[model samples]
Target: MQINPPGTVQEQRPDALTKYLQHRLAQRDREGNLRRLPQPTTGIDFWSNDYLGLAAGAAATGEGTALPCGATGSRLLSGNSQQALDLESFLAAHHNQEAALLFNSGYDANLGLLSVLPNRHTVVLYDEYCHASMLDGIRLSPVKQAFRFRHNSAEDLEQKLRRYAQPGTPVLIALESVYSMEGSIAPLAAITGLAARYGAAVVVDEAHATGIFGAGGTGLVQQLGLEQQVTARVHTFGKALGCHGAAITGSRLLIDYLVNFARSFIYTTALPAQAIDAIARAYRYIGEQPALVVQLHDLVSYFRQQLQERGLRGWCDSITPIQSLLTGGNAATRSLAGRLRSQGISVSAVLSPTVPLGRERLRICLHAFNTRGEIDLLLNLLSSCPNPDL
Candidate 1:
């Protein structure tokens, strides 16, 4: 046996685990879908979730000034603070809910809620395009069964609810108010109607809709007058709010239940004081500047009009800040993104297996800060590009 010096680290050759990992990565590389972290770049804003420009603006306001950097411990322990509690109260009122529970991010909120809410007899029927976090949460649960309905299709959801939902058994319906990829708005009224008829609880992920919709950015659930119909609503701050973390709004009983049973919330360290303060400031800022939301909507309308005037077709139907244009195949979608980036425009290309294999698209996000001239420049390039390989 060979031995090394006492302080020297051992060097080992590649093992089966290393080879397996390499093989998986190689497969993805061959498929033209290898994922990599992108370097930060500056240009016209067309790719971020910051719809209201609050992230930079709030930072300029010194929202998190002179605060601690870390939470110290989990919320169940020494991490909990009075500031957190006060912020929760403010969020509850802002969202028109009896109570609100905070989580580190939208993923954690969804995972924590879905994993605990379902029992062995509970059935979860979710939209096909629901976020991966929601799907992972359902997978972690002890729910009786889970099924995917067509994306934004009330008829398909109703069919599954009719077939699978049994009498006296709890049924959880999951969907997003505004889809991140497709930029399509959910038919909340029709879905809520079905939920009421079948006695199912609706859980709406208002991540993309939270900071851009409703009066004072309350979200689509409130904008459409469906707050009372929703059992729970998850609003993420990293998007349009220009902050970080997320909150689940619901009945006081629901908040209490999650506090006791949700492992993600119970086990993880709470958000730091700085984050909590920033969230509060963001809300206050939006409340004071209602015109920000109006400006964003006006920009959305302008974008659509430009697309029509340019006679550019194939853009997905969307009335929100998130807009997608389908450019099928990984090579084609990535090529399109490269072309845009070359022109000093920052945009994201959604490729498989994020979406289905043939459903690759370019996800373009609009913001209150974006100008019509910048939008026209983006559209001019898009109109000139050749058709993508499907």
Candidate 2:
């Protein structure tokens, strides 16, 4: 092999890197799928994950003065504080688990849990539509045998389990309580039942379901009384809770293992006291007013009814607040999203490679704060559109 000559840049040089990146972005631009930061607007609320309108609450105005400004280090370092410990304790009790371990965000929690815990001999079976974070964790793990079953199909999951499971190998089934992009829920009870027969541990990422389903906003796993059956549940603070960070609730042994093995947890700085305060406040608020969840569900029901009355096609059928209108291609979906924005409505265009090609969609997030008139106007706009069939 020949070495580089004097002043000759290597293949990994900055010029080479910039060229490759520019090429990829040019390809996206050609497909009409170039991504950019959206300008903030005071449009109708139909795109944010602030399910309970808690983000606009008094907490954002700095209502509490007890929280520290920053976390100095990782949880294993100076970042570990009494307040963080208390919040974890509160989470454990609320979720009906033996312990709770906190992470800076939902992505961190998933990465830490899946990447560090599973071994080369451990078999991981995930849903086909699990979140990108969970998929990333699996990709980075040493896990040797991992497969995905059809989304929400417990029968297919059982088939996979029967095929790969052995007498001594440890198995784990990963799922989301609600698949974020598709706005569909998993068959938790049935999947857990299958896991039980195979002696597999079941882990659920309840990022979208938290603070919207279970008693006192615990999550869907606890709402169905499957808390005892699930091996672990990852609850996030961003979606319905209107805050930041995430937690993994499970047996004390599991948390202990993660505390030791999770590189994302051990190497990174922890969530600040302010985020912890916001989470605690949100949980307390929901505990006092469980009707907020009911109100959100009612809105979800009304939106579904509106879709049916308008004969709207491509909307996902679910009682959940997330509703996606499949538009088949990126350019088309972006056009619809732009039209909605021009009409003072906010909606998200779910495009590729976040989703597969031919599956681009306009995702609408319903909330307790939306009004009947807002939903009606959105429906009317869609009904009069020139090409929803696009």
What TM-score, computed on C-alpha atoms, does each candidate reach? Answer: 0.83, 0.83
Global CA lDDT computed for model 1: 0.82
Clashing pairs in 2: none
Candidate 2 residue spans exceeding 4 A from truth: 1-66, 388-390
lDDT (Cα, tens digit) per residue for candidate 1, span 84-150: 8888888887787778999999999999999877777778999999999999999999886899999
In order, the Cα lDDT scores of the candidates are 0.82, 0.80
* Number of clashing pairs per prediction, in order: 0, 0
Best by lDDT: 1
Residue 248 lDDT in candidate 2: 97
